[model samples]
Target chain A: MPNIKELEDLTTQVRRDILRMVHKVNSGHPGGSLGCAEFFVSLYQEIMDRNEGFDMDGKGEDLFFLSNGHISPVYYSVLARSGYFSVDELNTFRLIDSRLQGHPTTHEGLPGIRIASGSLGQGMSVAIGAAQAKKLNNDDHLVYSLHGDGELQEGQNWEAIMYASAKKVDNLISAIDLNGQQIDGSTDDVLPMGSIKGKFEAFGWTVIDIEEGNNIEAVLKGMAEAKSLTGKGKPVCVLLHTIMGNGVDFMMHTHAWHGKAPNDEQLEIGLNQNAETLGDY
Target chain B: MKTYTYKEKKDTRSGFGAGLAELGRTNPNVVALCADLIGSLKMNQFIDENPERFFQIGIAEANMMGIAAGLTIGGKIPFTGTFANFSTGRVYDQIRQSIAYSGKNVKICASHAGLTLGEDGATHQILEDIGLMKMLPGMVVINPCDYNQTKAATIAIAEHDGPVYLRFGRPSVPIFTPADQKFEIGKAIQLTEGTDVTIVATGHLVWEALEASKALHEAGISAEVINIHTIKPLDDKAILDSVAKTGCIVTAEEHNHLGGLGESVARVLAQHRPTPQEFVATNDTFGESGTPAQLMDKYGLNSAAIEKAVKKVLKRK
Candidate 1:
């Protein structure tokens, strides 16, 4: 397990990467990516039992799929730092001929991505399917997935949630970045996903709550508990309560920053909050 | 002209089921997923025979599409079974991102396509599926004519890589195509040879085309009948060669005239070798609840309509 200081440093670096990548492209989702930085760092550094060299099927190692692919900054950062690719490639995000598209895709022959999931509500089902595949292959590795809170409004996510529980996809762990904010406004004001934990429990999932998803230690403990609940004949769902922009003070608790990149001055302020623990890409 | 015989009449969905069962026995990598439509899709035999390889995903077509895409990651060939309406339109984005765009080796098996879905009405019958699927890049669109052809196509798609849409129907139709005929992806089958007009058709319309050819032969028109099972990656050479001799074409299908097999053929002909063509298909109207025969007659997807279309195209030429 990584110490809190190391995980915190990793989170800072990921936040820096997210801001830098989104700023460079001038078009990408950065708020949710910044919020989910700690969770991703903890997963890669401690939680998941993944192989260093990537495999498409993830045969003998744990697998993760980003259902909320808009948070590609956090995903790509963690993936690169976890040794999937060089960290320098992070600069080419959303650029022409870059593997890191505006939305996460497997079409560019990225090693870590098994399925393309820029379109919302499809990732949970894909993750469930991957979990079922692991069972059929007799590989005991677990399948992990993450989705945004606003994405729950999509009918396909409900379909997937119903299926994962009904089909007893116990070898899976799904998380919701319950940031309560979308591109428009708060989730309550936009579509209102009321009682998300109760919703999953009602769908027959083993639900757990992480009160501070932005905190590395809390996120790690919540994920560990989620892993333990797996293999017990029920799918596990973690409702991660996180701030939209966790590191940068000025960007937090606002919907304006959900998709918009920071200006020159705001970028400098954001960079200062997240010091480059690992060298900046 | 050689006449065809139907020993038994069967639903094309049953052909898909039989093909899936056979595939299970032949290839260990082949897996099946049903969104609570195993019986409707005629996939019970495969499920019963290979219980471990089959998954009952309830009434979640979107989730089923995603799962089918994920199953391909481990090199497993997955066949997702659902109604034509749910298979293409309901879960289009899932199919687009996970299967087509991602380039997963998934066979989207859709049953009860077009007006043949019968009494369930316009809500159930899907006339735009062929167009929707064909529009996607790298997607193979297939609409087999009979039980034997559907079975052959099912087995053939498993061997080919990338995404494929295998469309079948619910009602029992004539089983005319030979069981021993080998199935090719983009090849059109020449059922009869003639000199005056070319009759091109797909799905349930192939039997109609055959009947139309017989009727035209009696009237001294000698119309050639071609079965175009594969709509996208169309058999241009066969169509152009036949049109070169015939000089006119009549396309028929159990779907809307717009974006159906007729339009696809017309596009090919217009680009390569332009020929006068007439379409015997449903107009831009929704299907109503009725018997399969009633719907076919109401939509003008019948032998008489095909025959009339052939004469009309020939007259224009």
Candidate 2:
């Protein structure tokens, strides 16, 4: 497992991967992917209790589900860097006949993905299901899931939210990427969801707020604390307040780069902000 | 000519419940989830016996679908029970992405299908479920004809390794098929054989086709009755072989004419045989509040309609 400094280097490299992969394709989301680099790095590097190889049925191990799958750039990067698949495979992101789809999917036999998720609000339900399965199997290892804050407007999330607590699915930790943006505009402008933490609390969830989501140390500490709350008869929810685009100066605090890729010049500037660390694919 | 008869009547949903209860006793990996339709889908026995294995999803059909897909991760074969409309149209994308495209081994058990979902009107009656399910890639679509066949299908799908849509209805129709009969997915059953016209049917309409065959026999006509249980991965060879001998065909179903079993048969005919055919289905219309018998007759999904279609197709031949 990587230390805080080493994890920071890996997080920088993931940002580079996101920018490069999306730039080569001239399409694919970059903003949310960039923002989630620290969380993904902290998760794969230090958080999850993973096994050696990949199988469809992830038994006796902690599993992760990405509810907001448009950020495949970050997911594919961390998955590759963590040795689920070849790091070189990141070059084929969203190309023809590639396992790296525009959204995260298990359809192409991707090693890290257990379910397909690009259609919003479905992941919470899937995560709850997996958590229930762990209970049925008597596997004590927990299930972790990440969702976009704006994706909560989809209504299915509330249904899953109500179900997880009602059924006492305590072996699960669901994290929300509070980047405050969507494809159209800021979530406030698009569709305001007032007091997300209050909403989860009212729905009977043990809410954990990570105020500095981009900060590596803060994320690791927050997630560890969230993990401690597991198996105590309530599903945990982490409100990670992250920037829309954390690494790049120009992309931050705006939703313009939510799904747009950087140009060749913008790519160089973005890459310069975070120097090559652990090498690129 | 061969004749068929039923001494008792039972709803196909009860067959699903019986099969689920049997699976609970036999297969440890089988789990049941219902969207507040436990009573309607007849899942009470399974829930009663295996309280831990059954998940009462409480009316959220979309969440039920996604959860069913997720349960497959740890090798749990989740069977989701709901109304046909909620099972298909209400959660099409969830099924498409989570179960179908992801290739999860989940059995989507749907009850109250087609116009036979009496008195609920068009809102609950799902006449287009077969079309919606069949269009998805790698989705096995099954519409069983009676109680015995439906029960057999419910148990059989758990053994099959892929996503399947098992469609049945609410009406307590005649129990004609054998109770111990082996339900083979994608295989059509030949109920009666003749040389003049082929009468193909599914779900509740299978009995109607058999009745039409008996009527046709009395009217100096020989109609071959074929029970098409599986809609997609259709038994094209059986249909082609029968049409080759009969020179015409009549497709009967409790679904709409568009994108239903009739259209699938027509596509096979157009590509292979191009035989003259008539459809005994709702003519691109919605069903209304009425008894199952009244709706079946009004929507042209009864034995008399099948008889009329056989006569019409024979004239074209």
Candidate 3:
């Protein structure tokens, strides 16, 4: 039910924002941000039934939490584009006195962020708690969260995962970014969690696998399917298979760009790849 | 000094349970989460009354802390129940990032704190929980004495709008405070007035402080007694005014000499009054297996210890 053309345009702008924001500071985790641009754009623009104005208590609306907070550039850009804050503030990403922290946090009173999450593996438990709250309120709304593939290594996620299914937290959707890369190396090199989909299935989540996570239509189709699977008896998990850096040529398929920013020449090349779709923030 | 008496004795954890049950009946927004040890936490009545509001997190303290933070997003005031050791040290990062730094209205109701949580020994008995909790900014740390006051503090924190670390213990100490007393955070209750050394105490030591005041009065010392329930956002006016009259202080608690209520009071006195003080607490050592009463006496956390501290600090005065 979305205009595919506009979603693509929004994704392009988000990619540009990710590059420019990180490039300005000569720092940030651009690999994950670029890879998650489409997911962020689709969630904010099409998927979530949200209010025009932001409230700390997101009561009556479908809530989305980015568990993999290093991808905050994409999250912030999409939030700005979707009218959470001024798009011009994207320039202050990771700067002093700015709400746009390198990782998403509510400590700065950022409107879109509900909790601080630079530290990995905490978002899942928080999301599950939100889902439980929705059930307590009889709100009939869904809670969605996105986590990095590498972040699954944290022991706390398993504790939360086991709890969600055991409690029948059926109104929640947790999507894992299956980019297979981390800061030090690929997930396999760091600490391999074999068969990520099978792992979630064993933990009792209804699994949805999207092979092309970077493609806007594929992600939309996958997410819609995920929303349909909710409210049954178990929490849902989406195995989003994506390249580390999808938009740019040099950064793709490598863990080297995990937390590094692009240089001036590399920035120009990245910008040339994604045209000015909705104008750079 | 004026004498006080209690008809019975009760654990502060039971007070928390009573307050939680009251909240369940009154405030529909209140929710309870426990990481195991529900019986130890004395949360059976609340869980039984409001099964939907109760969350059994099953030994995952970190996840419980995180979920408590998340529950605040949808306007549910979550109270996480666990032992003080696990509540403060084990899931510190989860609380730091999710609740404290984010400033969520989650009540971390920790039971079984300090040497009084005996039989389980040092692993379960956390002497430094007050210090660990009070160090976090925007975290309102409270260690109420007696069953009545803990219950009042529990009910009061639910009405407060920020993160609160509500600390209580397992042992059944004397319950002297009025059952219907209006509990105020950061406001010290003046138990007995005097002009000699100020005897400020918290947790299980408050009753000991009262007893010390009585003995000191009999010995003609005229000792002052104050109940410092809330450690952070401390009752500075009461402490400063009392110290202005008394000139020196003897701080006591069922905790360590470092980073506990004794140190918090010391910081305030050092900055303002510059009064000499003696601490009646565990001397930076771990507790061993013993009865609560035995441990209290061994670690200098009793009426006699408070009496000795009062006498020592009066010499400096």
Candidate 4:
């Protein structure tokens, strides 16, 4: 594995990739994607036990399901940077006949994506099922999932949350990007999800908190801690308190950039903020 | 015309369980999931036999659909069993995005479909599952005729690699199909031969169609009885061939006439060959709480209803 400095460089490139991909299409959710850059870098580069190439059946490797699929920019970046597919294909992010859809799907046979997820509130259940399958197969590898804080409002998350804990799905670790912002406004202003950590604990899960979700070291440590908490008769939940837009200066501190693409000048400014670390995808 | 008889009455759900248990013995990769309807879906034997392969997913049907889609990622053939109402309408989006669009090999085995859901009333009965499932691309919609055919279809679907909606009933209709018959996915079975009016039926209405054919024979009308088990990817050749000779058709199902088997048959006939058709289905209304027989009769889904429909179609011809 690469050192922390190398991982940080990968993170910088991922942010650039996210900015450019969305700018090219003039669509996609970049606020959450920028917020999740470090998390994706830490997960694919440091944490996960992956294979040399991607296969639909993630049999031996650690499986990850992106339930909050609007943030496909960062996912595609990390996947390409991690060798799941060619980095050049990231250019075709929402084009016609492009495998890279606005949301991640296996419909076009994208290698790393196990299930289709633009429809929120369904991924947690899918991750739970894959974790259960790992148990059934006697494979001890873990299953991980990431959901937006606003995506939890879909109500299917609660059904899966209740079920995962009740069934002791100890092989899974679910992380929510607690950015406290959504498409409309702040999550509190939108729907006011009362105490996400309290809710997870009440549903019988071991909860971990990362004060700064955008920090690479903090994300790496928090996820490692969550991994250690697994297999103890409860699924682990990581409440990652991240800023909606982490790296770029003008995009931070608001949910206004949640689904809006950066224009040419804004993209140039955003690209300048995060210099080409590992070269642009 | 050849006559048909049954020695016993059996619910189609039992055939599902029987087929599931057989798959448990024969195929190792087959797994089953249910959302708090094990007894009603008749999945006890498979659960009792392969406890590990069977999952009790509580009362969350949407989660059940999502989980079933996920299980297919690891080379597992997942069969989800639940009430038809919960299976289709309750989680249509989950089935649409996860299973259908993703093209997962999951079998959504729905029991207590249509008005024959009986006593559970309109809320529990699902008359639009065939329409809802068949509308999605690559989704195969199958409504087996009898208990024997249902069992065969349940087993055959695990081998086919895509999403399938297998709709069955709660009532113990006649076990008329062969016990050891090969279940074809999109083929229609010709139960009787005639040249007057073709009678195509599925699910609980199949037995009723046979009775209508017998009654039609007595009435001097040569009604051809064709059992259309698969609603989508329908046996258009069988329908067209029968209709070319008969010149008119009657479609019977325990569902609404709006989007049920009749409409699918109508689409095929309208595209390929124009034929006068009468629909033997509910007139787009919710079912009421009553016995299966009472509900079928009240909703006009009985043998008498099919016989009346055949006469109505004969006049159009």
The C-alpha stretches of model 2 lying farther than 4 A from their native spots are none
Q: For residue B287, what is the lDDT in candidate 1?
A: 94
Models sorted by TM-score, best on top? 2, 3, 4, 1
Docking class of 4: medium
What would the per-residue lDDT of candidate 3 be over residues B1-317, giving only the tens digit for each residue? Answer: 57789999999999999999999999999999999899999999999999989999999999999899999999999999999999999988898889998899999999999988899899999988888899998999999999999999999999999999999999998999998899999999999999988888998899999998998898999888999999988998899999999899999888899999889888888898899999999999999999999999888899998999888888887
Could you arrange the candidates by DockQ from highest to lowest? 3, 2, 4, 1
What count of clashes does model 2 give?
0
DockQ of each model vs. true complex = 0.75, 0.85, 0.86, 0.79
Model 3 CA deviation exceeding 4 Å by range: none
Cα lDDT, all candidates: 0.91, 0.93, 0.92, 0.91
| Predicted structure with the largest lDDT when compared to the true one | 2
Residue A195 local lDDT, model 3: 93
* RMSD (Å) per prediction: 1.4, 0.8, 1.0, 1.1
**In model 4, where do residues sit more than 4 Å from their true spots?**
none
TM-score of 2: 0.99
In model 3 chain B, the worst 10-residue window by lDDT is: B308-317
Residue-level lDDT tens digits of model 2 in B99-201: 8988989999999999888897999998899999999999999999999999999999999999999999998989999989998999999999899999999
Docking class of 1: medium
